[model samples]
Target chain A: MEDPRNRQYTNDEITVFWKPAKCVHATTCFRELIEVFNPGRRPWVDMSAASTQRIIEVTDKCPTDAIVWKYNKDLSENELQASTSTSEEVNPETLSTDPETKPAKVTIMKDGPIVVEGEFKVIDSNGNELKSMIMTSFCRCGGSHSMPYCDGRHRKIGFNDKK
Target chain B: MKEKSAQFRVIENKSLEVSGSFEIFNAKGELLKSEGPIYLCRCGLSENKPFCDGKHKNSGFTG
Candidate 1:
């Protein structure tokens, strides 16, 4: 069966897999290499954006198995079958890339970072514009050295949010 | 014409201030806030969650 949350991206030399269920939202992938793992783009993982080696390096930084990759020649038969399958239901609401997408998206991931996307500006408490980004991950664990931005410290600290 | 950029403000070591056109939702895909100028907890000490509750002082939470 097709898993809606399992996404795969390819670029001849390699194929990247994204398992949302396993994601700890470390923010490592995007923060280190937004060119390839851009959350603002639909099918967020764009393998073509970087070299196979660079992609592999960033994917390796993930603290969880949320993102994985393999050489196209090394893919197992089952993986190949799953990658080629396109039977999942298409839900427009879950579509990540609609040009006219909403003003901002704040997704509080379970045990992960708060993923924010869309055009927006970040201001300091003193009314200074710190940044204007299309997408970013905010640390909810409060253990990140990057301040508001997550640095994958939640996993190390085993931070848990009360339900 | 080009539009203005959204504003996000960091309140020292306490919280993040987001303003301008934006919408916020929790992990369950529930809509929480859709308006601009919202305070998000940065110190992770908020009892109210996501939003700042001014608990950073006691928590000794720093960036």
Candidate 2:
């Protein structure tokens, strides 16, 4: 059974599943491709905004499987039935940004980047504040093209934590 | 007065300096020994693993 809060968006080729409960708000979705996943917009996901291939790329970038995609032809019977009815849309903007200050949680992913969540600030080497949302991932691998931020290059470069 | 938020500083061509209130967990989700003002390895050359072992200088890591 699907969570009542879950949402699915479909284009002619694929369907993107969104599970809000699983989101750690790593901000990868909108940060990389806001054209399709804008939190500020109603019906937050617009499958028509971008090509299916482009959409798939961004969906795969989600740190937590908060959003995932599948080919339309591969949909299960239950999924096909569910698609007949419209599901209510919920935006990340609706998710509460707690007012109270608390200790941030930083987790190091094996062979990957450093994931940080909760309240915190990011400063560059020059002491300038970098814009941050609820959460973010930092590059641990020496080869990230986007310095400081993880562009999912750790996997490509074969970073090993134990080494 | 509100407490200062935790700070993550990207030290130029070096480790990431993290300060203020925060808890760091290893890949297994076990809480690691994270005292405030810790410098985490970013160059991926640290023999110490997550913590900086000053190897970035020798490795010529420029990111």
Candidate 3:
């Protein structure tokens, strides 16, 4: 059975498949190629932002098989035709926002700050705005000495989140 | 319904402010940070770990 949740995108040379269920939010895609894998952008995958080679390289780095790619030449005729038709019809606005606004998913790094995603607001202790970031890390180690934001001190202090 | 983007505010010498649709999990994958308006320690001096405990004031943490 076909899962409607699975999506794919392609340029003239290659096709990129997205399996959201497998995503661990490791952020490798966006961090490596924000121009193409910007989570802030709808559809979140812009195949045209980079060359097919670069896209393939980054896609391979995905820790999970959440994202995968294949050469257009390798796809069957039916797949090639589907790629073209669907690629052109993509509308950024049609993409889901925050998976229905449930809440931002926060992942605490093994030795780093907390990585926050989705919809949320961060205010200072006194109620001032520092910066609104789509994805940001907050200090968890008691050694940051910064208080709220991470200063990359976790690594220095050997702060293990596993504890 | 559409979800709004999350917002984060950094304090001058205190914790970072976070609100809106978000969740905070600990290193063990536990939900240590609460949703809603929560303050996370930046100075790393909070007795509560992630939450601000005002230790920065006594420690004189400039960051």
Which candidate should be chosen as best, given DockQ against the real structure? 2
- Stretches > 4 Å off in candidate 1: A1-68, A72-101, B1-5
lDDT agreement with native, every candidate: 0.71, 0.81, 0.65
Instruction: Sort the candidates on lDDT, descending order.
Output: 2, 1, 3
lDDT of 1 at B4: 52
Candidate 3 CAPRI-style tier = acceptable
Docking class of 2: medium
State model 1's lDDT: 0.71
**RMSD values, in order shown:** 10.1, 6.9, 8.0
Residue-wise lDDT of candidate 1 within A5-56, one digit each (tens)? 6878889899888877666455668766756776544666778777899999
Q: Count clashing residue pairs in model 2.
A: 0
lDDT of 1 at A40: 44
lDDT (tens digit, per residue) of candidate 3 on A59-148: 999999888988877887766655544432222223334545567777756556667765566666566655554454566665654445
* Pick by TM-score: 1 or 2, better one: 2
For candidate 3, the per-residue lDDT at A51 reads: 90
Ranking by TM-score: 2, 1, 3
Q: Model 2 over residues A112-154: C-alpha lDDT tens digits? A: 7787877888998999997755566788988877788776567
